[model samples]
Target: SSPLPTTVFEDEATAAQKAIDALKAQGIQRIVLLSHIGYSNDKSIAAKLTDVDVIVGGDSHTLLGDFSAYGITSSGSYPTMAKNKDGDTVCIVQASEYSKAMGELTVNFNAKQSVDSCSGKEHLLLGETFTRKDAAGKTVTLAGADLDEVKAIIAKDAQLWSLKPDASAEAVLQGYAGKVDALKKEVIGTASDLLCLERIPGMGYSKTPGCAEATRAHGGDISNLVAFAFRDMSITSEIAIQNAGGVRIDVPAGDVTIGTAYTLLPFANSLFELDMTGTEIKAVLEEAVEYAVKSGGSTGAYPYAAGLRWTVDLSKPAGSRFSNLEFKGKKDSAWTPLDMGRTYKVVTNSFLAVTGGDGYVTFKKVNDAGRGLDTYLDYAQSFVDYTKKTKVLNRLPVSEYSTQAIYDKNGLLQQ
Candidate 1:
């Protein structure tokens, strides 16, 4: 591709500043910036931009205001105030994630188009709680309740769902719902053994051990299987890597259904291949290990690769966390240290290969340099293909991973 066009996308703060400057130049004061850059960035902009009066932001999924009445935790105060470089006041606010609450911020601007005073509250919308039979066959009432009078008032709201459904919309939803239900019960394949959904503790953020803990110490069964599937489908890939977060669930020791496959790899990310040297691959692994350590054992960034293996030492600093790196060209081949100078064909999800989701910035750099190829292969489908080919998924293979005494007996990192 003629060295993919270099288009520099500005970060949120820079882009917001550009827009604010433009508006100020146009004599537009009392500007309310609707931002999705997140709460922290909003505060940064408030501290930096003198012209912005208020910022309604999202993306950190931050909860603001005193939601204690509703039993929700507020991350920070509502309408957080900050002074700009010129000492002008700016107001910042954000609603929590997934529309669970709506923020109502009232901003009063002074004559100079700066915030004078502000007050706001987050309104939490909850479902109508009702009484139900307990496991002991006793009737019990849920703590939160919606009175009949309140229900009557809400019934008058045109936006609320009606007891009488719309004929056309209901028909469409019913058709799709039926199809979904059928697919959930449809068998795709089978497994000879159970794939534990519980995360391997001690290795990830948790410290509790599970049946699959050993496998996940290096790479879990689902992740390894997914990586193998990607390589199998690719034309130029000699190895494949999958992120732990991408593999969402486990396959039980029974028939593997379509639902099972979908649950295993829920993301829509496609397969991507790239030419990366052994050195770059090692760096990628190091990044993953460091991320796990820094995140207190978060598995999201942990890398699981087919035809690749390595050990991690939490005692080591960031760049040196990974060691004993090895790779194999085929299943029956002997393992060998990664050749730092040799470019190897590697396969990974498009999310990591292109945008570097979950902090795989090294891969993103390679993709930006036009060295990566977008195979456009559906990731979840790759799992399905592997299931059909293997026919039965037995227990996960023993891991080649190793880690030092990262924590002391008191559950703290050993110094």
Candidate 2:
């Protein structure tokens, strides 16, 4: 048998240009790129391409419109306009993350095959019923005048859509609903307390009461736990790293089910192990913090880890921000200063294991050097397995948290 040829991947702009050229050759004058490279990359691609007129993007999960009336903050305006290399108009848009909203954009092209204008808004899909917590802290569904007032508010907001489920779709779903419901109901374990989900510490964005106060100094509880699970499942790995964005949703105090695990780590990512020196690990953390906090990138790029801890001062420059790095091989081991020359096995999701995602350039270098190995373990399943083995989920001891302390940009300590 002949040796198989290796596949060579091209950069986004190059690949997009090649496809656009083919389309133009086929008499397609207007090009709309259905992109998953994320909002930031989409804007860069739009600026580089001459033929692409519009970009519908994903991956970053950016909300590209004003949705404040619904108590949601948006990243930018809908149909963010840019200019191509030829100085022609290019429009880019993205809906929010987690299927919470849908973007609708309209582009008008002139006879010369250039974009003349673009406009649109995101519609937040909602059900007919609404609920609120009463003075007694019990959830209750609205009714009577309250229901009417809620309906009126929805009617007034053009971006809010309250739609009933389609009868035919409901019938189709019913066929498989029984098995799906059974799978979703399979309880793996229980949480002793609400594990709050927050991308960045001190943001006060956690929905659970007291979560913000608890996590303001330590960072996200769920993200740290997910990183610990990855390290635990890897068996031989000494450390684990996870991007905050990878773990989604809070785990309320109660039974943790298969559905909960899936919802938490929803992406189709697998576990990967990389042999890295402490110096490399430090560089990776700096890169993540630089991109997310210092460079005004997505807060989701913030790094979380098991077996590692550091204090970050936002007032300092990127390279100098992280300090007092420590490492422990096992839960029972004493924490010691990280040795820059020592090599250790690090486990992380496939997303951060590769280069160019979330500014983890050091991971790319180690992977390219042939020191990386894929465990082929589904990340979400790893958490499920961990839950079953432990039988209980509780907030990790304060000492085990990855972030020991953080200082704000003004050099004041964050509470």
What TM-score would you give candidate 2 relative to the actual structure? 0.64
The models' CA-based lDDT, in order, is: 0.71, 0.88
Q: After superposing candidate 1 on the true structure, give the runs of residues whose Cα lies further than 4 Å from its correct spot.
A: 1-7, 11-14, 17-30, 47-54, 70-92, 105-121, 130-140, 143-179, 196-219, 293-301, 309-326, 330-340, 354-365, 388-391, 394-415
Instruction: Please estimate how well model 2 matches the true structure, expressed as its whole-model Cα lDDT.
Output: 0.88
Q: Candidate 1, 78: how far from true, in Å? A: 5.1
Model 2: per-residue Cα lDDT over 1-415, one tens digit each: 1111245657989999999999999999999999989899998888888788988899998987787776788888898999998899999999887877888888888989899999888888899989999999999999999999999998998899998989999999998998889998999999998998877788865678888887898899998999999999999899999998888888999999999999999998889899999999999999988887855587888889999999988889887889999998865569999999999899988877764478888987888788888898999999999999999999999888898998988998887
lDDT of 1 by residue, 1-415 (tens): 1223466657766787889889889988878889887788788777766577788888799988765653567878887888776787777888787867677788888887777888876655456654667789998765534457546654664322224346899899999999998987877688887665422224433233454444434435555666777787786798887777787776667899878888888887888888999999988877765665474646587677777776655556779766667777755457788788999999999888877766687888888888898777788877777778788877555542222123322445422
Structural similarity to truth (TM-score) of each candidate: 0.68, 0.64
The clash count of every prediction, one per candidate, is 2, 0
